[model samples]
Target: MEFVMETKNINKYFHKPKEFHVLKNISFGVKKGEFTSIMGKSGSGKSTLLYILSTMDTDYTGQLYLNNDLVTGKSQRELSRIRNKNIGFVFQFHYLLSEFSVLENVMLPAKKLGEKSPAEIERNAQQKLDMLHIGHLAHQRASRISGGEKQRVAIARALINDPTILMGDEPTGNLDSQNSENVFNIFKKLKEEQGLSLLVVTHDEDFAKRTDRIVQLEDGEIIAQ
Candidate 1:
């Protein structure tokens, strides 16, 4: 089967206060349309591995491939372009621009990508918000929405670019159980109906259990899959 993203023999280290290895020979692949979760205790390098997989951290040794393209040694500019066109990320914190309207926040990435006309971008952004059931809040200030609504908005924003893969790092970590379930249901809906691939980092067991597969990490190495 083809994969949306793969990491082979990935290794990472930190030299800040002292040299410390974070990720060790991490390898995995996220299949097309598969919903997979990465789970590990705090400081297990789950987030560190995710940084490398997402192509945001280039200070790692590995063969990183996304959409069948080798991105391991790409320049920052090239990687940025590739990421804008291919990957969507949702963090534990919804990094929405508080001053912008929900619709604007969603349109930001699409606008930066510049692959579509402004009017087209607006239409696409609205469609994403509607798909997430937040179209009515599009004109509202991002700071004014509820936490759950904010996350949905964030997901909408992440989808605005029509990325090949959606990656989440503790996407529901800030939500209450009820809201977390809401977010999970949305993810499931997208995977089932839209056939979008997803790789999520989560500590919530129930959430991890619900995914198609679980990749567990311990001390920066994949311990189970």
Candidate 2:
């Protein structure tokens, strides 16, 4: 299997004359299509570590590479393109555009990646929504859908890019138990069917434990891998 992401001696810190370290010498590699979870208590650096891994925050020490390419020194324009094309992100909040319909929400990323005719984009968006079992909600305003439906649309949007890797910072954070499980099941399906790597930051131990591999972090350092 291909290595989806790798880091060596990666460290992150917040400095203000006095340095405050948040991530301390962490290293790990994730394989393609593998599901891995990073777990820790509050302020254990779990979220901080995830941000560095996902290419969202890059101001850190040590080598951080995505798909074997060193991500340092890339221009903002270059990085933005990379992010749009190769990686997909789902945050704690379903950042759906309220003004757009469900189909439009899923098409936003694809539109940014490359320009396509509206008809074509809609076709693609519908296919992705169908995959997530939310095609019926395609015409509804995002604000009108339930939280679970909104999250499913977010997942569909992420998948529309056909990203090599998907990163989740508590993707199911706001959902109830049933909805959370449904979202997680979608993640599993993506890994099995699309060979997509996943690195999710979750406080839910039950969810973390279900992943194929677990990386435990505490005090900014990786305690176990």
Candidate 3:
């Protein structure tokens, strides 16, 4: 089967205060266009594994492959480029630049990528906003939007580069139930219609249950898939 992401024998450690094994020999794979969730209680190392998977944390021993390319041990610059082109990230906080217009916020990543002209970038960003049903808010300042709108803007920003994989860390944590459900439906639509692969780390049971697959972690180990 084709895999969008795969991890093999992953292990992590924490030093400074003491040498603590935070992740132990974890392994998993995400199929192309799959919607997967990693669930765990506090201190289960779910976020740590996510960072490694996202190429944000390389201080671990394992092999990581994204879109069938081995990404293990790549230099910081190389990893950054790969991440910019192939992966999108959303965090618990929307992290939108309050001073920027919603459209500008979405266009920033494409501008940094520099693979498209300014006009192309603008059109693409606006398209993403439209896909998220927020195109009408494009000219508004990000700070002026509501919580749900901001989250949608953040998602539009993440999609600006047309990444192959979209990763989220507690993406719905800041929203109310209605907004969370909206976000979930958006994800479902993305996976089914857009063929986007998603890996979300969430503590919400309802959200976890709805994903294509759930990988459960406990005490730094993957207990179930």
What order do candidates take by TM-score, descending? 3, 1, 2
Clashes of 1: 0
Q: Cα miss at 38, model 1 (Å)?
A: 0.4
Record all residue pairs in model 1 with backbone atoms less than 3 Å apart, i.e. clashing.
Answer: none
Clashing pairs in 3: none
- Give residue 21's lDDT in candidate 3 (0 to 100): 99
Q: Which tens-of-lDDT digit does each residue in 63-173 have in candidate 3?
A: 999999999999999999999999999899999999999999999988988899999999999999999999999999999999999999999999889899999999999
Instruction: Report lDDT (Cα) of residue 68, candidate 2.
Output: 86
lDDT of 1 by residue, 91-162 (tens): 999999999999999999999999999999999999999988889998999999999999999999899988
Model 2 agreement with the true structure over 1-225: per-residue lDDT tens digits:
568788899888899878999899888999988999988899999888877776778798898777889886677687788888888888899899999999999999988888677788889999999999989999999999999999999888887778888889998889999999998899999899888899999998889999999999889888998
Model 2 error, position 173 (Å): 1.4
Residue ranges of candidate 1 with Cα displaced over 4 Å: none
| Candidate 3, backbone clash total | 0
lDDT of 1 at 6: 91
RMSD of 3: 0.6
Q: How far is candidate 1 from the true structure (C-alpha RMSD, Å)?
A: 0.8
